[model samples]
Target: MEVLVSEVVGRGTVLAGRYRVLSPVVSDLAGASAWQATDQILDRPVRVRILEHGAVAPALDAARRAALVTDARLVRVLDVGTHEGYGYVVSEQLVGQSLARLVAQGPLTADQARAVVGEAASALEIARRRGVHHLALRPSVLHVSPDGRVLLGGLALDAALLGDSGGDARSTTRADAVGLVRLLYAALTGLWPADPRAPQTPGGETLPPAPIVNGSPVAPADLVPGVPNDLDTLCVVTLGPNEDGPHSPGELVRELEPWGEIRASVAETATLGEPMTAQFPPTGAAAPGGGIPVPADHDDQDTAPVTVQRQSVRTAFAQQDPPGANRPGTPPPATPTRATGLGPVPSDAETPPTGLPLITPPAYTQAAPPPPVVRRPVAQATAPPPPPEEETLEAFGFNDVIGAETAAPTTRRFDPTALILILVAVAVIIGVVLAFRALFASFDTGASSDTDPDPAPSASAPAVADPAPEPTAAETPVAPAGGPPVIASTTSIDPSDADGEHQEDVAKAYDGDPATFWYTQTYKRDDFAGFKDAVGYAITLTQKTTVSTVTLRTNSTGGNVEVRATDAANPTAGPVLASGAFGPETVLTLEPATETQSLVLWITQLPPAPEGGFRVEVTEIALS
Candidate 1:
């Protein structure tokens, strides 16, 4: 391994004459290099790890032991050999996406997340039982193959290459247990809740760092809404600063078995080299429209109209099985097995030839009943006569009188409806009067205020000139007070950035264009989860000037922002010029600030963004 040189290993460089390197996957990794290669004989892509300076004995031994494990969840090791004084181990290249890449896009569903993590835990448990541990497990090591199989790569070999040791097997196993939970945390929230001091494997940052407050990782549910309570509790308790997690991987397996079962069953019928989503082809009624269910307003274009046929009313609540659930592409039910002493009878089996009364359909005992029974009475068979003309008078309250059909048969009865009408009319008139009074009262009040009599100025004083009309909103100038503050340049300051925080677009903030502005990196929490206290822009004025106010027009509002007087690239806590929340129009008044050529716009807290997480956007800045 010491003799291996960097120049000898690279793209198109063959090792041991059996594996051909395609490209470098990870470079300068822990005194070693990993390459994506192909197996010459098998004509398949394989990963080859070349050690430039390390004891190959340990790595080779570890890889050999890992190769013996039969767990399907573990990536299979194909070959390990020395080529040109370089030690290399060949592994089957994963066809699907790495956990990091998938998570970088977005989070997985609860079931998918749990299922994948559970399988990873189970795989680690298998390796632990065989006295092997992968202390360097990270997001990149775990993968979901195209066929929907969960596979863990690197196994014990990753630890060996990195020279990672836990002093004993138990310690190493414990580290792996924690690693599995971390993977689970990432799957659910797309955040890593690891110790800030520890260095993560390359490509692990596909998920952002989890928000940490007071030296402990924040709860998962706190970052992503709708996280299951059980999952949230488990993550908080396990990945907390205390590190009180499962003692063994088996514990994780049992707890996650419920979620893993669904994914595991899905994997059984997965087709090779097909995307994982293809494994979940539409089922039941969804099969009719080519894996899409019919919408409420399908319009019969993509979906075929279904018509159900009924043979008899007895089928409605019959004890017999539903006739194979008449659906598109539905398979017919298998024939029921005959009763045999060797096995139990099928549930849908027909009655035996002996014709026992218990199971057989009963025979018709009485003849078919007569059918014709009309709505007309069973005895009458003819329509009833219409009501008499005198009854109609009762309808209008003219016929029936209270005492003694009256002293005179010719006397007419008074109707109660007439009294009700009179009362309603009176109420309507009173409501109209009250409404008019209120309306007149409001008019009088307005007139008194608008035309309040100024004390009559006798001819003793000259009449005062009429006051000039106030300007309307439309007539007000929309431009800045002193015109746009000339900004010479700007720079971004974000401690959380591993490479650069959109540095190329820093000028957009002061470009004098509202539509184009600079944006800060999205974070898991409003306070950046303690990753950093603040992030914003540092502006350099075209010339030093004493400005009393600094106004910012931003894409959003509600952020803790401050402006400090400084000319340094990275501003320090100095004399503050202005400070306030980010706004569509945030105006901050300077209090006795000194003249300075440079200024810093720092935002300590951010408001919620339409996208999940918190962010800041500054479109333009002005100084006066």
Candidate 2:
């Protein structure tokens, strides 16, 4: 690939009708250049990389393959195309300082460095799970956000088109792990090892080659003193010439994860000191008392020292003389000494003055009970004479309205026994219904036997009856010979090359509607000339059953189909059971075998359709 003149492409140059180039970001040694661009249609920023003319189609395919994965840590390839003599790939314009730029300023702290590399490792793990290998990872291609976020750009497509690397997937992954360790080392020591394979900066500046002595890069311990022993050892071992380094990014991530946490804990522990309360002086200057102020009546009941509140007079006296001072005419104070119960006060002792006199406790004695009071009767007043009353009732009807409604009949109390009888009757009815159901189940089995002697007897052709095995609970009793089989689930391998949104047609075929169907895409030849083998439809029975026959109804039959029974959802591993050329309507009687859960209708060969192309349309399928 030859480099085009720089003047041919510059700022404001537009390519592929959608991406308008804003400015040139970088130019590779192979004449490939990446530019900042804008997507005119989507109204978003994009990065457009122009490659040699011959590499357009392959790069475009690679870009489309990379687009299948959606991860925020990687720059997304939006579109790829060729215009004039150059191939251009439009990618999401990343907004952050490149790792190269970040390192140019200064080295990162161990925590920051680990965070960047760990995040990158997680992204690599995701891509690896998705079957994507980033073979072009380098510090220059990596972007760092203000908040330690690492984004890996420069996808493998770029490397593929530029012929930068020839390593396979395994080698690529190992190289990525090595790249991460190198990035970490650079972040720690601000010295990047020189490697021709490492991606170059936009200005095409390479990192200073690491000073190597005795077949190994000089250790970070010799350059930076306080680098942790674990970190230094990890860097040395990972970058060592021996094949003992981590082989994958996950291995590196696991080894690094604990170091960051352990370092953080050590730093935190070193910063911790005595509690603020403990730092305070034990005298009154700390608080109103020697320690935290407590309510007067508060008590912990423990032997720990307590802070007693001094009264105003005591405080004043304490300031004058903390211990009781002896006055000139007070016969001096009693000597300040510990006293025992048998000892007398010393002549020169100093004793604390008491605020109030102590009173002796009262002697224990039983108190006398109070006497009961006697009530005196007062003079009684004379009562008035009783009033006269009439007890006769008045009625408007005959016989005095039935004797005044029979004394307003007494209210009746509820009887719970009637409710209990009703409940008993309901229980008896339910028991009878269950018993009848049990009796009718036998009749159902007899009816099924009478109708379906063989589970899958063909209509157009007679099928040989298979040995009737003992029925199991999982066997769904076949309905009659002509009835549809009970289906629990339906699945199909709908090749994407079909008319309209045909994947939904898979459900329509199993819906038992004669009007709807699932049709194969028109092919140039009968055997799905351009498609892979094993393109088919599958139906799972409601239970594991020995299918006797399968009947297919279709408007057009342009393929020889195979009917297979297997316990696996995917029947690709084994040979199909039965196969024959199908007409407009076809019936296949299966040989009696062990119960199978799934039945597949696969296309083995194709014939020309009536409409002049090779296709098959199946409207309905019945299995019994």
Candidate 3:
């Protein structure tokens, strides 16, 4: 049942003036009606997810926020609005199958699992940074693009439509993070880790839920063989890692990035997708009555003189090995820009393939190796050229010689002793070459003693440690010598307002999310009405990182804020590092930079809110 205030719209029903519903009706996760529809306005296909009218606010806000995530692997949200009493979100349609349909057949190969889940994790992590959470990330919401790219759908709107995201920001973050690891487990073992007894899993119901014991999911390795130790540990540890808790999506991406397309899965191609070219062949493929011209009898058809017959494109590609793919130390051959030997089509390939039209490819010539230059005797004016049969030894030997031709036998041109001198000179030259070769052979055999490989290192040898894995580029600053502050956590502080609950929201300001914000309590006056001097939030860094500047992006302009170096999550007092009035963006600089584990952002004065009270909403906070 749709949230239609009027009559139910079936197939071919137009909604929101342009979308013509094509899918009859489908229900899942959100208790919503989903349809495949054609956008008459754009003249293209689109996916429309329709929910009840009550979910309009959250779903619309979530869709708008999710639209700000600019990753190619994320499905684009085209429209979000109300039609009649129903709220709907329209997104781009995918031509390829979803991971649900793919996994329905069988478990994916390890490479496919990693790539699909890895790319999904990457996109969701990017979405998380934008203050949008796909609390419902799972196989069904993940799709394979036509080019094999795995894309994530329903970034924020899914959870909104499902009504599963009423938790605070921290809980929502953890839910999304844990959801990513669970997806990895499901992709690997074909068993979903989310509790089976729950009404629904993230991204809706798909695979059979994993077996549970004592409130915990079973490890994937217990069911699957050859699952890598690292991946297995990643899946299991997140269920319970350490005191630090479940792993975040950023953490998952670090582990998953290296194994991209780790192994080939071409054997599952038929189950994965239909060969796109077979359904619609290339241009000129369906010519009538042998219309394609045969280049065999053409004058320029002789590409190059060759002793061997040329193979068809298919046969040549089958034999071509990837560089360093097979035997080691063998040099790779040159790959051609275009395939050759398509001239008249082979005698064995005259018939078109069944159901597929033959594509008569354009004719092209292959480059040939150049002939070697040779020195030959020149014919004299008085003499005829030497007979072709006795011409010269140039064709048979690697030697070059010059001489003149004559009509008759001439008197000896030089003394016979000259030949003897020439022989002596050749012998001396050969002896010198042999002597150098013997010398180099002695050097090659004799040079080894400085650093012996067999001996173990002494106890005093300096320890060599493995390099730490590099985090994704977004998390780390570009130049670390004196760069951005690496913040660890945040909390709001208001000693005067004892009942004020702001812990969950202090994080939103500096969370790298552009949509969320941290705001102060509304006061009747522009300044706190004869209350405490200020109310603000504090930032705890990963370590004692230096800070040269603090930047903020806020919805409320002209409000006053101060930066303070402090150790308190709930600071009562601290030394001011910098102070300034807020604009659309505000930057506060500290001379010579300060190194510390925690810093505070104290808001003293508030800007007037649109309705009545004075308040401030800081969208983002940055350190550099």
lDDT of each: 0.64, 0.58, 0.63
Ranking by lDDT: 1, 3, 2
Any idea how many clashes model 1 has? 0
Kindly indicate the candidate among 2 and 3 with the higher lDDT: 3
Q: Which parts of model 1 have CA positions greater than 4 angstroms off?
A: 1-6, 26-28, 260-624
The digit string of per-residue lDDT tens for model 3 on 219-323 reads 766766556666787777776534243445666655664332322233234321131111101111212473321112222212322121112122223343444
Residue 271 of model 2 has an lDDT of 12
For 532-576, candidate 2 gives per-residue lDDT tens digits of 444677777776666777888887755688877753345554566
Question: If scored against the real structure, what TM-score would every candidate get?
Answer: 0.41, 0.41, 0.42
Q: Give the residue spans of candidate 3 off by over 4 A.
A: 2-6, 166-168, 196-205, 241-246, 262-624
Clashing pairs in 1: none
Give candidate 2's total backbone clashes: 10
Please list all clashing residue pairs in model 3, or write none if there are none: none
